[model samples]
Target: MNGHEQGNSRAAPSRLRIVVDTDMGVDDAAAVAWLLSQRERPVELAGVAAVWGNTGVDAAAVNVVALLRALGREQVPVVMGEAAPSSGPMSPIGSLVHGADGMWGRAAGTIATCPKDLVAFYRAVAAADTTLLALGPLTNLTRVAALAPDVLRRFARIVVLGGAWRHGSITPVSETNFWHDPEAADRVLAERLPIVLVTRDAHRAFALTHDDLAALATAGSPAARYLAAPMRAYAQVTGRFGEPLNFPDVVAAVLAVEPAAATVRRSALVRVVTGTHGLVRGQSVMGFADNERLAMIEGGAALARLVEQALAEPTLHLGRALAAILAREPDNAEVVLAVDAARVRRSFLCALTREART
Candidate 1:
């Protein structure tokens, strides 16, 4: 049943309105799942703009549709975003870390995203004065800001799951998402918006232990089951390497949902290495003073349990209705319009890539 039809379990109008933009991977999928699981509980979980990181931007949106369906949260549509970075070397989707697809092998078949007009849809839903939870590269936000800087800057807050001052994701000094497109990161970071950065330290801080999954073996909820299989798969990998399953994006997600949970370790203007040269190429550094809040959470077992509980809550989301509509009505005007949009997006990406490098 669509979220619209079945109705959300928690409908408090006072809840905060939030949007999540992601790059689907095992971790990102895990984050998206956590976000939906909290739908209408404390936040509206408004729109999701699926952009690039672990997979192609559109590919992430396809997985988002399937995931939303799995959790039953179709009322909040997933809009496909920038296929490539606005201004840096694209990262190849390596390691089946999330599986061959973006999720637990559920992203194989063809999937359709919200009616073809991604730009319009993204603009329509990512309204001014709303909070934004960015869980991927800064590519999509850069593109949007390029279209309307004022609108982008108007966001009440922008919580990023990127950056690694204390560590790295791709290199010893660079985080994967920021490293993937440092130019875009530079542009987005230069904005006037109040930014909250969930550092890599937060990832290490808010992680899952083998015992956590052991406990989930009995939790009865779609979110728990959805997280269980893939998490177990993840645990198997980390177990062999003797590492914990960290949920950095969830830290950012929780910050978006509950701003009070975060402790801003540093508040400063940030800068990222944009020159295509060394180990510090994507490293994001901070100036001694500013409005951006670099966040970290230090809640031992409590934080872990918070994420576990979130996953255990069911989310109401949509059918593959968009797929069905496209299947039955292949000639729909939206499809035609979407083709044009793709060309525009491609042109923008190409131009930005060239200009940023120069």
Candidate 2:
């Protein structure tokens, strides 16, 4: 079932309206592209909010605009956010992973403007049923909860692409996103939002290999060229001893739109503890399950299908079945049309490689 069909079958009004909160890394960019292209949830993409993680919000905002423009989604308001928290050591940059200025080296000017307040911004956009697809650190979100608890109460759910039930990408215990902002994580989990935890334990189920990417690059599509730079970057940074880096986050976001299309296990409460001994700091713990287990299982073909559909469809406009995005985010129109056709061509090649393997 699609996200909405799985939620409730009785007289549904329309598709799920979602806002992506991301750090604008290559993986996050992939996730955003994938989510926006989905027909299942038919994400509205109210706005792209930046947080401090792979890159700071300022840089992230610029990168978001660039990627959106590349995808032909420039009108999507790329909102700048807190460069750093009110009081804390700034989070370290994953420049080696995302490049110096976030978009694999593309530079663009970001106007010095920001939302008057994030809590208010969220309140204005989110209804009682909006979903927040969070693909970065929880700093902005956590801050929203603290300043205006009621504003946060309106969100229907928060799907976090950070943390790990056991295995971690950054350190033995902590996932890089959570480790960067543990305080925010604590606040997020504490809030009563129905959290769909897409942890490392779950994300690892989907892997995009080098050979997989290389095949696409050889295909000579516009999307293939787009995927080349970041795919190479990802392989270089997160890899261990020549092994390719395992990227499950972007694929996880794709899976979220169609959970039925994926194999996912459920957990009652997923929490992180900041202070601890060696190899245990920032580790994610599940209360009920001894270890995280799959509640749902989607085959590799299902994921491949999701990617295939995204690549096939035009990212320039809202799906005919769902007009909410086009209606609400009218500003995104030019960016949608301005998408580099070549980049889209490359994306198709990447999907073709995935399709062939599947």
Candidate 3:
């Protein structure tokens, strides 16, 4: 059964309260857009914290608010997260990777109010049993882990888009997020709190095809247009290397609600090393076998459907839609599969067409 299920009906989880930390990259924008589109779902857009990864922290913060407003989620708080790793100086990733000003280099003034401290913001809401989705570096999360270990346990789960249980994106073994802040990644993973590390290996399964973008664009919504361009850019870079963009993070966000629709694997003791591909690069080691498995939920179609449904409304992708559908069949895989396939096909066709022309 999923976390939403097997709970007291009277006081069951108050929807999947989530605080998403993003760097405002193209994919990051899409993920945020996906969440914003879910206004009718059970997941609550508690807050959005921007961290420096694909772009500057300031840029990321602006992008978050712009995306929220464009998607009609201006009410959702857009907080500025960590500027960068709280360690030595580091170089920016690349403009092509995350665009000029992170999410299209928009203005920061767009955001209603910038958050004071991302770590503290996360700590406060986490106590309400929210799931923290770390889409960027784990700096804020690491800070929280160090300051209040209870906050880590307060949330039912923490879904991180970084780390590579098997490999990395910048290197053969080290992912960029972990490499940027290995100390933080290591600290967060060291904790045994119910966590799901959507590693590169698992993320590869949710690659977005050109067809997907095309379909989204054809949808003729602001989000669809917003999603189409970056998606196209992502395809360009990946096509150069003949690789697909690892998108497990987006899937993880959706699965945070309906986890039973996935195949989970457990890692008891997980650790991450620092640096680029070298002797002491970012490496993960398992200390012991843990009963808790990282739920490997792979329903591209279902996720695509969720994305579409979330984006359909444009303003707010609340978790009410997912909750409503989920309330009926809380433990049925076939039902989830049906939703997944239908959604995937729609997005795949559109994205695929857009990529071909561009």
User: What TM-score would every model get versus the actual structure?
Assistant: 0.72, 0.72, 0.72
Question: What does candidate 3's lDDT look like per residue over 1-358, in tens digits?
Answer: 6667657345434566887877777777766666555433566878888778788787777777777777777888777767768677654764666567765444445643596676677666775468777787788787777777777788767777666655567777776777778877877765656676666655556666665555665776667765676677666776887887545446655555555434544444456775454744665543332111111122356656776877887775546654454343222111011114223333333332332222
Collision count for each candidate, in order: 6, 26, 43
lDDT for each residue of candidate 1 in 111-185, tens digit (9 for 90 to 100): 764564555755676666578888888888887777777766656778887777677767887887788888988
| Total clashes for model 3 | 43
TM-score, candidate 3, is 0.72
Q: List the residue pairs that clash in candidate 1.
A: 72-316, 72-317, 73-316, 73-317, 74-317, 74-318
Stretches of candidate 1 off by over 4 Å are: 1-13, 39-41, 87-89, 93-96, 115-118, 289-358
Off by over 4 Å in 3: 1-14, 38-41, 106-113, 275-280, 287-358
Residue 165 miss distance in model 3 (angstroms) = 3.0
Q: What lDDT does candidate 2 reach at residue 64?
A: 76
Best by TM-score: 3
Q: How many angstroms is residue 248 displaced in model 2 relative to the true structure, after the best TM-score fit?
A: 3.0
Candidate 2, residues 1-358: lDDT per residue as tens digits? 8998867876533776677887888778767756655344456777768877787778787777766766667777656665774346765657867777666765356442545367667877777667778888788888888788877668776677767756776787677777777667766776747676677665654556667667756754434455567777667766744644555456456544555433445545455666434465556655443212111122346545655776688673324422332232121000000112223333333343434353
